[model samples]
Target: MADVSDPLSLEWGGRPARGAPGPMLAALEPAAHRYRFQQGARRRSSVTYLDTVDRRLRKKGLSLRYESDSDSEVLVASAPDGIDTTELGEAPVWPALAEQLPAGSVADRVGPAMWVRAVAPVVETEVVSREITARNEDDKIVARLHWQEATANGSPTLARVSLDPLRGYAADAERIARLLADSGEFVVPERSLAEVWLRHAADDEVERRPTITAGMRADVAVATALLGFLDAIERNVAGTIDDVDTEFLHDLRVAVRRSRSVLKLTGDALPERLVARGARELKWLGDATTPTRDLDVYLLELDELATRLTVGTRADLDDFATHLHWERTVARRSLVRALQSKRFERWCESWRQSLTEIVSSGGSEQSGSVEELARDRVRVAYKRVLKRANAITPDCPGERVHSLRKRAKELRYLLEMFAPVCDRKPHRAVVKNLKRVQDILGAVQDGEVQSASLRVFAERMLDRRSASAATLLAMGELSAGFAGEQRQARDELTDALPGFLGSSVHKRVTAMLP
Candidate 1:
C-alpha cells in the first residue's frame, strides 16, 4: 500500500502535436548523456474507474478504480496522476463496498453526494504502458518515465506521459518536462482521466453554488442562490429515483425546503407570481418527500434508538424493528415512484423555466441595497424569535415552542444565506445564539416525534401482529423516556432563553443589522 498523501508522480503534457508515445520517447533519447535512458518492459492492461452519478469523486481530485490485472479486486483510491493509492479493501462485488465504507474521512467527504448513487464502470480503457528510467551520470536513477496509450472499447482514445521522479530530483523532472514540451512531442492535457471520462459520458458539469456579495441586486442575488440549489435538486433527482442512498432523498428534501424558505424570506423582493408558483410547487415537492424522509430518519436512528432500552429489553424491540422496516420499505417504494413520475419531471421543468424571468418582473419594487435588505431582514427575524422565545412559559403548549423553533430556523437561514456579505464577528455571534436555541427546540420536537411515532407504531404492530407483548411494553417505556426528555428540554429553555435573548446577543444582532 502506498501513502495516499505522498505524491507518486508528476506529469506535464500538451496536445499530441505529432508522433506516437514511442517516437516521443525516442525524441528524448538524443540527450542520453545527461539523461541516460534505459528502456523498461512494455505492460498492457484494462483499467476501469468508478464514480458517483454526478462524478463526486472526480470533482474532489480523487479517482477510484479496480484494475482487472491485479490479484485482488480491492478498490484502489488514487489521485489523478495514478501514483499513490489508498486501498479501500476488497468486496466480492464492487457495489457491495458502497454500504461497507464506514463514516470516516472518505465517507464524510464524498458519501453525501454518492449516497445511493451506484458505483459502476464508468470508464474502461486498454492501456499500453512503456517504462523508461532516466539515470544521472553516476548511473543512479533520477526519474522514471511512463508513456501510456489508452484505447476505449477498442478505439484509440488518448496518450500521455507521466514522470515519477525520485526524492530530491524534482529539478531533473522539470527539465525532462521542458525537453518534452520543446520537442512538441505531446500537448499538456489539462483534464484528468476521470474528468475526460465524465465529459465523454455526459454533457453535464457540476453546478456551481452561489456566493453572494453585498453589492448584488436583491432579486438577482436571491435568484442566483436559489437557482444554484435548484440545479442541485434536479441533479439528485435521478439518484433519488434509483433509491441509491438515503442522502439522495435527504438532499432533495433540503433543497426544496431551502427553496421554500428563500421565497418566504424574500417574498416582497421577488416577483409575486414567481414566488407564489415556487411556493406551491416546492410545497408539493416537500410533501411528496416527507414520508420517505421520515421513514429514513427512523431507520437511520434505529441502532441508537435501540440503546434507549436495557440489555434484556433490546431483544423485545426486534419485532417493532421489523414492523418499522417493512413500513419504511413501503414508504421508500412510494417515494421512488413519485420521483420517477412524469408530474415530478414537469415540476422540475416548470421551476427551471421560471428562472429566466424571476428577477425581471420586480422592476422598481425590488430595487434596494442588498446589504441593507439582508440586515433589515435578519434584524426582524431575530427580534421575532426573541419575542416568541420570551412568550414561552414552562406551562406553554408544545406548539408554542415548535413555532419558535420555526422562527429560529428562519433566522439562521437568513444569516447563513447572507454570511459571505455580513460582518464576520456579529453575524457569527447571532448564528451561534440561534443554533443553541434551534438545537434545544429541535430536541424538543424530536422527542415529541419519537413518542408519537412509538404510539403509531404500536397500533400498527398490533394490527399486523408483528410485535410481541414484550416489545409493546418496551415501546411504552421508550415513549415515556422521550416524554421525560421533552420535559427536561422544556425546563432548560428557562435558562437558555435568557442567554439567547440576552442584552448582549440582542445588541450583537442589532449591530449585525448595520
Candidate 2:
C-alpha cells in the first residue's frame, strides 16, 4: 500500500444519487484521457469492530475487525500507516479472548494490549455497496469505487461514495478529484468511515472518571464522583450479565466497592436517609456479585497456582479445576439472575436519578466546597491509617492488620476521588506510597483467604467425590504454600511499614490533601 498521508488530499467521498455514475464521476469535465466504468450488483456485508472490554486496542492506536461476506470471514487490522488482513477458516464464537486467536500478526499486536481481558464486538454494522471499476481503454483498472451505505442498530451511518486510487494512476486521480471539488457535491470529512462507525457506538465513553471542577459544592461534588462509579456499574451490567469476561464482572464489583467506600467516608455531606439507603442497596449488589467474582479469580489464577507445585504435577489439579468450574457455573446462575432482577434494575435507575437531582440542586451557600471537604476527609482518613499502622505490632492479630488495610483503602479512595483538586506531583507521590503499602496488604489478605478457601474447597470436593486423592493432597500443599507466602509478605510489610509511617511520608500525604 502507498502512503495515504492525507486521506482528504484526494477529496474522495461523494453522496451520489442512485443509478447515475455519481455527480463526481458523471461529469467528464476537461480530461481527454477518458475512463470507462464497470459496475457490479450491490451486495450486503458486515464488519464488527472488536476490542478488549477495557477498550485496550483503541488505546493502543489500532482497530481490529471481523468482516463477513456471504461465505468467508476475515480479520482485518488497520492503523494510520497500513492495514493487515487474514482469513479465518471460520468465525470464532463471540466474547473471544485475544490469546484465543490463531497465531499471526493480528493476534500478536492485540495480545499485549488485552492482557487477561477478552475481546468482544464493540460495534457491528451492515453495509450495502455497489462496486464500480474505473479503467482506461487498455482495460487496466485505474481506480476502485464503492457506493457504500451502512446501518448500525437500524440507524444509517457512513452514507457516501468513495474511491480508492490505484497505484500509477496519479493523473486520473487528480483530474477526478478536481472534478468533484469543482462540482461542490462532495466535501472533505474530518473522520474516516471507521471513526464514524465508532462515534455512534454506545460504548464509546471509555473514560469513566467524572470531571469534577474546582470549588464545587461538597454534597454535589461527592454525588458527581459517585455518579461516575454508578455509570461504570451500569456500563458493565450487560457484559457481566452475559459473562462476557471475568474482567467485566471485576470492573463492576470495583465500581460498587468504590461507591460504597465514598458513601461510608463522606456521606455526612448528604442526607442521612439517602446515604443509608444507597449504602444498603450497594451492599446487596456487592454481595450478589462476590461469589461469582471469587470463583473467577480462582479459575483465572489456577494455571499459575498449578505451576507453583513441587509436591504434585500440574495434572494433579485437573480434578480440582473441574470442581471449580462446576461451582462457578452454579454461582454464575445466581449472579446472572440477581443482575437481571427488578431490584437491581430499579436500584441503578433510582440511584442515578437521585444523585443527579442532588447535583442539579446545588449545595447551600453555608456549605463548604469539595476541596474543603476533601481536605477534612483526607486529613481524618490519613490519620486513621496512621493510627492503625502504628498500633500494628509483630504479634498483633490478623484483624489489626486487616483493620489497617481497610483504613488505608478508604484513604486511597479519598485521594483518588479528590485527586482533581490536589497538586499533581504531590497527589502522585502520595498515591505511589499508598499503593506500595497496599500491595503488601493485598498479598497478606489474599494469602490468608485463599489458604482457608482451599481447605473448604478440598472438603467439598471430597464430599462430592469429585477429586482424586492426589488432587486433595496437592491442594493441601497449595494451601501450605499460601500460608508461607502470607508469612513472607508480612515480613516484607514489617520491614517496609516504617518508611510509610515516617514524618516525610506524612508531610507528603498532608500536602496532597486539597
Tell me the alpha-carbon RMSD of every candidate. Answer: 6.0, 4.0
Give the per-residue Cα lDDT of candidate 2 at 149.
Answer: 63
Highest-scoring model, TM-score: 2
lDDT by residue (349-440, candidate 1, tens digit) is 87676764654554344457577778778878877898899899988998999899988888877887788778789888888877888888
TM-score of every candidate: 0.76, 0.84
Q: Ten residues in a row with the worst lDDT in model 1? A: 1-10
Off by over 4 Å in 2: 1-20, 26-44, 70-72, 79-84, 88-93, 99-112, 126-139, 142-192, 199-210, 393-395, 502-504
Model 1 steric clash total: 8
Q: How many residue pairs clash in each candidate?
A: 8, 0
**What lDDT would each prediction earn against the true structure?**
0.72, 0.80
Regions of model 1 farther than 4 Å from truth:
1-8, 13-31, 34-36, 40-63, 67-74, 78-97, 100-128, 133-207, 311-314, 360-367
TM-score of 2: 0.84
* Candidate 2 positional error at 434, Å: 1.8
